[model samples]
Target chain A: MTSARSNNTRLLTVFTILSVLFMIGWWQETDVSIVRADESDIGFRVNPVIPTNQEEKNASWFRLNLKSGDTQPLQMNVTNTLKKDITMKCVPTVAVTNPIGQVLYNQMTPKRDDTLQMDFTKIGPRPFTFKIPAGKTMVVTQVIKVPKTNFNGAVFGGFVFYSNDVNAAHQQSASSSKRGVSMFNQYQIVVATVLNINKAAEVTPDLRIDRVTPMAYRGNPAVTAQFHNTKPAVIEGQQMSFNARVYYRGGKKVLFRNVTNQMNFAPNSTIDYVISWGNTRMQPGNYTLRTKVTTGGAGPSWNLVKNFTITGNQADKLNKGTKRADYSWLIIFLIIAGLMLVAILIAWVYRAGKRSSVKNAGH
Target chain B: MKKSWSTALSVAALALVAAPVFGNVASVQAAGPKSGDAALSGVGYANTNGASGWPAAGVEPQTASGTSVAGIGFVAGDLTLNQVPVFDFGVHNIGSSETFSMQPVDSAFRPQKLSGNPITADTKANAGVRALVVTDSRAQMTQTAGYQVILQFSPLQSAKVNDSGQFLDAKGSATTDPTKFTYNTGTDNKPVTMSGASLQFSSASVNPSTDWNAFIGDSLDFGDKAAIYPAIYTNSGKSGPVPAGSMYTTQTRLAAKDAPAAVGTSIDEGKAQVIYRANMKTGFGTWAYDFTAPSSVTMKIPSANQQTGTWVSQLTWVLVDDPTQDHANPIISQLEQ
Candidate 1:
C-alpha cells in the first residue's frame, strides 16, 4: 500500500507539471501573437490636410484647382504610431507610366515628357527629410507655386512618404543570420497632389509613338515600344488595346506579337511597352514593327509602322548577353563521346578476328 | 483502502489542473471581439469563408465542428495591406551542383482561433494560408479608381557580418562582402549565388464578389473563375434550360474583358513586377493571392551557385494610386454640382 501510494503521488506530480507547462506555453504563444500583431501596426500613416480650396472632401488625396502663378501651402499629417520617434523622407515626384502601362508616382526624377510644360517637381518644394515624434502627428508642409506660364491641362504629381523605421527593420533583417530568401517588407504611402490649371474639356488627348529599340527587359531579349502621351489630359476610364507585331521588313509572317488589352495612359507621361522575344536569338536583318492602338469609343487610335535594322555586331552582342542556356560544350562532348565509342568497337572487332585466325591456324 | 485513496487524490489533482486550462480557453473566447464591433473597424481579420464585407463588422465567423474558428485581427488599414508572406527556403546541404526548387514554409502569422490558438485552417482561411492580402475600404459614396501593388526585389545578401568585416552565412561561412553574393542569371560574374534563381507565384483568388461583379458583369459566377484552368464557353445567346445550381453560369471567356487583372507572374530579382493591378472599375475590398498546393509559388535555385550559408533578399511592395485617373477633375465636377 505504501509503494502504490508513492507511485500515485509521483504520477500526480508529473501530470500536474506537464499540464502547467502546457498552459504556460499556450499563454506565451498568445502573448507572442499579440506582440507580433502590434509590431505590424508600428508604422506611420498619412492623411492629407485638406486646404480650404480642396475639391473633394472625402478623397484621401489632394485635388485642387489653382490658377497660374497661384501659391498655396499643401500640407499632410504624418502620424507616427510607434513608441519611438521615426524619420521619414518625403519625395515629390512627377507621375510617370511604367512599362506595364500603369502610372506610378513613386519614381523620383523620372524623365519628363517633352510636351509636359508644367512640371510638378519644379512647382512643389524640394524633397523634405524630417523626423516625427513618437505618437505625434507632424504637419509636413510643401509650398506649391504654380508656373507663371498658363498651361491648358493638369499637372499630376505626388508626395511619397517612406519611413526610416521600416528601412531600419530592413537593415536589421539584412544583418540577421536567417537564410534562404528571407524577405523584409518596406512600405510606402503616396499622397497624390493633382493641380489643375484649366478645365478637362478644354484639353485633348494625344499619343505619340516616341521610339522603338531592342533592349534587355527583365533579363530577356525584348523590343520596347515607347508610347508617349503628349497631351496633358489623362487617357483613362476607357478600354484601350495595343497590338504590336514584328516581322522581317516585307515578310507576311509575324515573328513576334504582343497584344495588351485594357491599358490606360497617364497624361504627359511615356509608357515603354516591352515585347518579349521569347528566347529567340536576335538576327542581323531589317525588321519592321507594326503597332495598332484602338479605343472602342471614338477616342484616339493609331496604326503605325516603323522599319529598323539590326547589325551583325548588335545581334552577336545581344545573343551573347541573353540568359539562354548555352549547351554548345555539351553537344560537342556528346559528339566526341559517340565517335570514341565507335572507334573502340572497331578495335575490339579487329582483335577478336585476329585471335580467331591464330586459334584456327594452330588447330 | 490506502490504494483507493491515492488513486482518488491523483484523479482529483489532474482534474484540478485541467479545469483551469479549459477555463482559460473559455475566458479567451469570451474576451474575443464581438460581431459588429465598431472598435474593430479599420483593422484586418482573417476571412475563412468566401463571404464578403469586413470580418469584424457583423460578418459571421466560420464554425468548424460547432466551434468558432474566427480569424484574429492583425494590421491596420483603410487602404491597407493586411498581409505579405515571408518565403523561407529551409536549410539545405552545401555544395549542391544541380538545380533545385523549394516551396515556402507555412506562414508564421497563420490564423489563430478566438482563444489565440492555432487551428489547422485550410486554404479557405485567408490568414492561415500562405498568401498576400490587400484590403481597400477607400470608396465611400462614390466609386474610386483602383490601386496597384508593385513588387520589387533585391539580390540575396548575407544576413550576418563577422568581426572581420566579412559577411557570414548561416553556417558561419564568411565572404569578403555581401555584394559578392548574387542571384546568378546564368551568365554572370563568379560569386556565391544560386544560379538562375527566380520566384514565381500563381493561383489568385479575391474575396467579396461584389467588388468583382461590379467590373466583370453580374452574369458570370465568380467562384467558377478559378485560376487553375481558363474556362471558356460560347454564349448561347439565350437563357436556355440550365442545370441545377448552374443558373449564374454564363458565357465566360478568359479574355481581358471577362476577367480581373492578372496576378500570376514570375518575379526577377532587382526588377519591379506588377503582381496585382486593379484598374478603373475593379479590385475593391480584399483580394488574396493564395500560394497553397497546386498553385505554384516556388523559388528555383540552381545547384551550381549554391553557397553554404543562408541567403536573404528584400521584397518591397509599393502600393500607389492609379496615376491614370484624374483625381482633381472629378472632385472639381463634384464641387461644381
Candidate 2:
C-alpha cells in the first residue's frame, strides 16, 4: 500500500510540472506580442545645437558667417523616446535643384552644375552612422573645414538623418514576395546649412537659354528649352514668370507656347522646361523658339530667342506607332471624281465633232 | 495614569525631531530637477515640435489613440510628414494583358480630441483614405516661404516565391533596372510591366484654423468659418462646385510658380517628381492630397508582359526646403546691400 501511494504522488508531481511549463510558454508568447505592439509607436527627434557664431538668432536652420580657413563644429542632438536602442544614418549632401525648380537637399550623389565654383560636399560633414541607447540622447558632431581660398555667395547643403533600425525591419518584412504590387514607405528629416564666406561680393543673378530640342517628354511629343542659371546667386522670392513660344522660322504663326509664373532657380543649375504637343504629330520643319522671362512682377526680365530644325528622319521616328489623321479615303474620292469629269468632257467633244462632220457631208 | 503620561511625552519628542528632517528632504527635492527632465539650450527654439495629430474627415486635427499604423506617429518638428499611402494592386491572372486599378486599403487609427474626448462614437466615419498629409507650423514663428513635397519611385521587385518555383522570391529582387518599369526582362520567364504606371490625384486640400478666416477671406470666399481650401488639381467632371461655407481660394496655391500646367503629370521610375509645392506666405497647418477614385490612380500591363507572380515597388515621399526662400535671408540681404 505504501509503494502504491508513492507512485501516485510521483505522477501528480510530473503533471504539475508540465502544467507550469505550458503556462510559462503561453506567457512568453503574449509578452512578445505586447512588445511588438509598443514598438509600432516608436519614434525619435533630432535638433540642431546652434553655436554662438550663428548669424541668425531666431533661425531654425544653420546659418553661419565664417571667414576663409575657418573651422567649425556642427552638432545635433538625437533623442530616442523608446525603451529599445536605435541606429541612425546621417548623410551630408550638397543642395541641387529639381526639374520643377525646388531646391533638393537629400540627394546622396547629385550631378554638379557646370558653374559650381565650390562643392559643399567636400567642405561639409562626412557621412556616418551611430547608435543611441534606449531613452537617451546622443550628440552627433561633424567638423567643417573651409578651404584656404575665399569664395563668393554661400555654400548650400543639408544633413539628412533617418533611423537605420526601422529601415532594416521594413526590408526584412518586405523580403517575402507576393503576387501583384506591394509598396513600402520611408521617412527622412533634413536640416539646411548655409555657410557664407565673402559677404562683400555682389549678388548678381543671370539666366541664359542653353539649347532647345524636340524630344519625347513623358512618352508624349514635346519641345524642351534648357534654361541655365550661370551665376552663383539664386533667383528667388520675387514672382518670376516665363513665357516660351515656338514658331516656324521667320513666320508669325506660333506653333507652341508655354507660360509659367512664380518659378525660382537655384545657383548654377539647369532646368528643362517642357512644352507638350498634345495629340499632334511631329512635323519636319525649321522652328524658332522665343522665350521671355520676368521676375518679382517688375524685378528683372529677359527676352531669349533661338532657331532649331527638325529632320525628316527625326519626325518619322517620333511619330512611329502614334495615331495620326487618316487621309486615304479623301485621296481616293478626289481621284475618282477627276476621272469621271474627264470622261464626260471627252464625250461632249466627240458629239460636237460628229455633228460638224454630218453638216459638211450634207453640203 | 503615570504610564499614559510617559508614552505621550515620548511621542511628542519623536514628532519634534522628525519634522525638521522631512522639511530638509523636501527642500532638496525642490532644488534638483528630475532624471528625465531636459533643458534645451540654444539661440533659437528647436523646430522639433511634434505634430498636433492626424486630421479627421472633417479636416480637424485629431490625436491618435491606441496602436497606430507603422510609420504613422508624431514627428517632433516644425515641418512634419504625417502619413503616406500604401498602394495595393490586387492579384491577377498570369500572362494576360490587363489594366489594374488601385485597391487602396485605408489604415485608419482611432481618433481622439486634444481634450481626451472621442471625436466620433463610430470610428468608421472618420476612416482615412489614400492620401498624403503634411503639417507646417513654422508660420507660427513668422517663418514663411513654404516647403515642397516630391515623390520618387523605385522599380517593382519580386517579393514572394511560389512553391512551383515559377517566381523568384529573393528580397529586393527586381526584374527591371532603376530607370525602367519592365519587370523580369532578362529572366528565363517572360517579363511583366505596365505601359503607364502612374499615381493620379484628384484634389489637394488644406485645413487651416478658424482664427485666420479674416486673412484667408482676402483671397478665398469665407462665407462659413469652417471652409476648406480648393482642390489644386481637380479631375474633369469628378468634383462639383465649392460648398456654401467652403469656397475655392488661391491664398495657398503656390504650385503654379513651378509647373503652370501641372495637371496630368507623369512619373518615371527612380526620378523625383514634385507633387506639391508651397511658396511664400502659403501652405500652413494641415494639407492632404487625395487619390481615392477608381480612375484616379491606374497602371496598364500589356498582355505579353504579364508574368504570373507578385510585383512590388516603393514610393518615397520627400519633403524638401525651397531654395527660393534662401534668397530672403536677412543676413544674405544684409551682405548684398
Candidate 3:
C-alpha cells in the first residue's frame, strides 16, 4: 500500500510539471506576437494624404507673333499640413509641355522668384506639372523672355516642385496657432503673362530732329528739340538716354554753365528743354547742336539720333542790321538790292574779261 | 540538558553551512532574462545640422522617397525656421530605467538636464512617466501617450528692461516676482487642460509684498487633441487676464512706451506678452520658450491675436524632427533670459 501511494504522488507531480510548462510556453508565444504586432504597425500605410497641385493666379502673358526663342515665367503657391510623428519634405520642379505632351523647359532646383523676364517668341504655349509631398506647398512658375536672336523651333518652359526627404519624411512641425493636419500631397501652378518684342529698334521708333533754336537770353541760351515714338504700341517704363553736343562753326560742344536734368522723354513724346550758360555772357557765332536718345526696354530696338544748327546773332551788327532787317520794306529792299548787285557784277565782270581776251587775240 | 541543546545547535549550524554543497549546487544565474539593451541618459545629444534654429530658406515639405511633399504651418511668414531641437530620447533597454537628463545641447542655448534612464517606474505601454522639457518661454507639464513631459523654462537673453528678468533656477524662482508654479497634469495619462494649470513660486528674491512683479512661464501641450485647430494658452482660465502673475503688478516691461491706464488693456496693450521679431534689437536678452505642438501644428494666443510665441518671436520655440532617430522628437527652444 505504501509503494502504490508513492507511485500515485509521483504521477501527480509529473502531470503538474507538464501543465505548467505548456502554460508558460503559451503565454510567451502570445506575448511575443502582441509585441511584434505593434511593431509591424509602424510600417508604411497608404494613409490618404493631401495632394499638391498647381498655383492659379491671373498672370498676363504677352502674345507676339515671331520665329522662336522667346520664353516667359509664371508662379505657384504651396502649403503644408501634417501632425506629429510625421515629418514632411518638398522638392519643387517646373516643366513646360506642349499640347502634344512634350517638355520644353525642365527646372527642379529652387530658383530666384524675382519676376522671370520672358521672351514668348522663342517659347510656345506649354502646360506645367508641380509634384510635391506632405509638408509644404510651393508657388512655381515660368518667365517668358524674347531672346536677342530668334530660334526655329518653339520652346516653352515653366517651374515645378519635386519631392525629397528634407521637405517631407521628417517634416517640420507646425505651431499650435497654425497647426493642423498639414494639407498633404501638394501640387499647384501659377500662370503669368508674357511680353514679346519682335522687331528691331531703329525701324520701330525713330526720333526726327525738327529744329534746334538758340534763343536770345540775358546771359545764356536754350536748345529746344522734339522727339516722337511712332510705333502703335505704348512702351511701358521706357527710359531714353541722349548726349547733346553744341559747336560754333566747328564741331564742338558749347561750354554751358548749367544743365538741368538728364534728357528725359517718353515714346511718341515730345518736349522742349534748356541748356543755359547761366548769367554768363555768350560767344556769338554760328552754333550747331547734336542730340541722341537711347531706346528703353526695347534696347537697340529704339535708338534715336538727331543733329541740327542755329546761326549765331552778330553782336554790333545785330543792332545795326536789326532795325533795317526788322523794317518790313527795308528788309525786302535789301534782299532784292543784294540780288540785283550780284547780277550787275556778273554782267560787268563777264564783259570786261571778254574785252581783255579780244585785245590779246588782236595783238 | 542545556549542554545537549548546545551540541544540537552546533550540528544544526554545520548542516546549514553545507546544505548548499549537498543540494544540486549549480553556477549562479542571472536574476532575470538576458536583456540586451543599452542604458539611456535621461538626456541625449544629437547633431542638429539642417534641422535646428531656423527652417531652411524656402524649405517646403518633402516625402521619404524624396519625391512627394509634406506641409508645415506658417511660422515666419516668409522663411521657415528649420531649427531642429536635438533631444537625447531613446530606450535604455538594458538599464532601461526611466530617467530624465537636461544638459545643454548647445551651452549658449540653455543649461540643464532632467533625470533620464533607469525609469522611475517601468510601464509596459500607456503607463505615465514625468518628463521636464526646458525651453525659453514657459514651463509646462505634459501628459504624453506613455509619459508626462515637463518643459523647464530657460532665461531669455533678450529684454529691454530685465535682461535677466526671465532668469530663474531649475526650481523657477525669480528676483522680482514671487513665483507660484503648479501642474494641471493627471497623476497618470490624462489630459491636464488649462483649468488645472496653476503656478506659484515656493520662494522669491523679489519684493512680492509691495511690488507685485510676478511672472509665470506657462506652456500648452497641443498633443494629440487640438493639434490642428487654434487654441489659446493663457494665465487665467480661458478669459481671465493673461495671469501675468506679479509681472503684471510690477509691470517692469512697460506694456507701452507710455503706461496704459488699465495695464495691457489700453492702446499699447500687447493683448498677451509678446515681441515681434522685426522689432527685436540684437543683444537684448528677452524671454524665450519652446512651445512644442506636435505634427507641425500652428499655435496662437488669445487677446487680439495671441500666437504661441515661438523662438522667432523670442517667446517660444520648437525642436525639429529627424525621422532617422529612435523617436525623432526634437527638443524645442524659445526664450533666453
Candidate 4:
C-alpha cells in the first residue's frame, strides 16, 4: 500500500512538472506590430464609368462580360479640386505579381510585355486627353471592340491618369532662362478594367512551379518558390501551405524547417512566394525541399518533394543578406527539462521497486 | 507505477511533437479563403505631361471670352473664380435715371432680388464654391506670413482697350429704333457722344459680427467695409481713373497699393481657405449701408436719353503663382512644390 501511495505521489509530481513547463512555453511573449497603408498623398480618385447602382455611389473596377466582336463604350468622370486647371492623360497597363505574392499595377511606358495580348489602343482610348478646370469636373469615354476570334480567360488592363502640369512647368522653365531644375510633383491614378471574353472558351488555371530560390524578402532572407500562373483565369482564395526542410544529401537529420501559407497568383503572371524560416543559417550542402499546396474549393492539391544542392559560394552569398527571425529559446529549455524529467522517472522506479521488496520481507 | 510513468512520458512526447502544429493552425486561420471577382480599388497618384493654351483675346470687353486652360501638377498654386457675376437691369422708361448695386451670391447668404443663377466656372459635377484656393509649394511659404486676396474694379468707362484685351463702353448714344441698336459703338457705326455714364463702388459691406467662414488669417470687425475706389488705367497706358469705362486690373495680389475689398485670404499652407460675406449694394447704385433696402445688385440707366441701344462692359480675371524670390521667370517657378 505504501509503495502504491509513493508511486501515486511520484506520478502526480511528474504530471505537475509537465504542466508547468507547458504553461511556460505558452506564456512567452511575441512582438507583432501591424500598420495599415496611408492614403493621404493620393491626389485624385477614380471610379467605374457606369455606377453599379445609385446606392453604391462609385464602383472601383470594371467587371465586364462580353462575347467576340462585341463593342462596349466605357465612360468615367474626373474631378479637379486644385486651384489651377489640370490636364489628364490616360494609358493602358497590366497587372504583375510582385515577390511578396501581392498584385501590383505596372505602369506601361517604355517597355511592353510580349505575353500580354490585349491591346489598349484597340479599345479606343489609349492616349485620351481632357482638361478639368479648378473645382470642376470632366467626363471621358472610351469604346472597346472585342476580336471576333474565340478567346477564353480574362484580359486585365488599367486606365492610368497622369498629369501634364509637371511637364509643362518643366518646359516653361527650360525655355525661360531658369538656372535650376524645376521640381514637379507627379502622380498616377489607375482604374483597373478587366475584360472576360466568350463564355464558350476555356479558361483554365494552369500553374507551373518552376524552382525554389533563396532571396531577401522585406529585409529577411527567405526561400521562395518561383511559379507562373500561365492561364488567363485568376487564381485567388488559395489556401497554400509550404513545408521546406533542409538536410544533407544523404543525411536523416533536418538542419532547418520553413513553412508559409495564404499565397495567391495573379491572372497570366509569374510570381515568387517567400517561405518563412526563422533565424536559420544557410549552410553549404545538398538539400531536399518538400512543398504541399491545397487550393480553396474543388481544386487540386499539390505535394512536391524535390532535391537541390547549395554550393559553398551560394551559401556565402545568401548569408550576407539581412534575415529577420525570432529564435524560441523557451522551446529549447522545455525540451531539456523534459529529458531530465524522464531520467527522474527511471530513478523513481528503481527506488520504488527496492522499497517494495524490503517492505514485503519485513512483513 | 511503471505504466503510469510511461503514459505521462508519452503525453509529453506528443506535446513536444505538436508544438509546430499549433503554428500551422494559426497560419491557416489567418489566411482565410478569398475568391471571385479578383478586383481591387485603391488610391493611386497620377502624373501626366502636356501643354495647355491660354484664353484668346476678346474683340470687345463685353464679348464672351474663350476658355482659359491652366495645367496643375501635384502641387498647385493658383487663385481661381468660379464665374463672373453679371448685373442686368432690364429696359426702363425713357428720361428716367435708374440705379442698381451688385452683391455676391452664396448659398449661406441670399440676395433679396438676384436676377438669375450666378455663373460658375465649374461644371455640373462640382457646383459648390465659397473661397479662393491659393497654393504655395515652396519651402519658404511655411516660414513667412500668409498672403491676402484683394479685389478692385476700373471706373465706369465710355470705352477703352489694353494689351491683355478690349473693354466695351458702359453706355452708348441713343438710337431712334431699338432693333437697330449697337453696343459700345453707335448704330451709325461710330463712337457715340458720352451720356456721362458713371459707376461708384462702396467698400464691401461685410457682416463683421458674422464669424469668419473660410478666410483663414485676416482680421475683420463687425460691419467692416473694405474700400473700393474708382481707379482706372488712362488711355495713354498709365494707371489712373478715367471718366468713361476706364481700364483697371484687379490686383492679383491683395497687398498691392489699390487693394480691392478682400473676399478671401489664404494662409501659408496647402488648403487654407478664408470666407467673407458677399458685398451688398443699394438700389440707388451705391454700396448699401446695410441689408435694409432688400440688398440687390442693380444696374441703373441714370439718363433715360443715354442710349436706346444695348450697352456692355467686361471683367477679366488673372490667376497665377510664382515664388516671391524667383524674379528671373516669375511665371514659371519650380514645378514640384
Model 2 stretches with alpha carbons more than 4 Å out: A1-44, A50-52, A55-58, A80-83, A168-178, A199-201, A325-363, B1-78, B89-101, B104-129, B135-146, B155-197, B206-269, B277-312, B326-337
lDDT at B257, model 3: 17
Alpha-carbon local distance difference test for all models = 0.55, 0.53, 0.26, 0.39
By DockQ: ranked, best first? 2, 1, 3, 4
lDDT of 2 by residue, A2-83 (tens): 9999999998899899989989976543322100011112245555656768855434467777778889877666555556
Model 4 spans with C-alpha error above 4 angstroms: A1-43, A51-58, A109-125, A164-186, A200-202, A216-221, A237-262, A276-279, A304-307, A321-363, B1-337
Candidate 3 TM-score, C-alpha based: 0.19
Q: Every prediction's TM-score for the first chain?
A: 0.73, 0.74, 0.27, 0.61
Write one digit per residue (lDDT tens) for candidate 1, span A156-195.
8888888767556544544434344565666677887777
**Model 1, B104: alpha-carbon shift in Å?**
3.3
* DockQ for each numbered candidate: 0.09, 0.10, 0.01, 0.01
Classify candidate 2 by CAPRI docking class: incorrect
The candidate that achieves the highest lDDT relative to the unseen native structure: 1
- As for candidate 2, its interface RMSD to one decimal place is 14.2
Q: What is the lDDT, from 0 to 100, of the residue A33 in candidate 1? A: 11
Q: Model 2: what is its DockQ?
A: 0.10
Candidate 3 chain A weakest lDDT stretch, 10 residues: A34-43
Rate residue A122 of model 2 by lDDT. Answer: 83
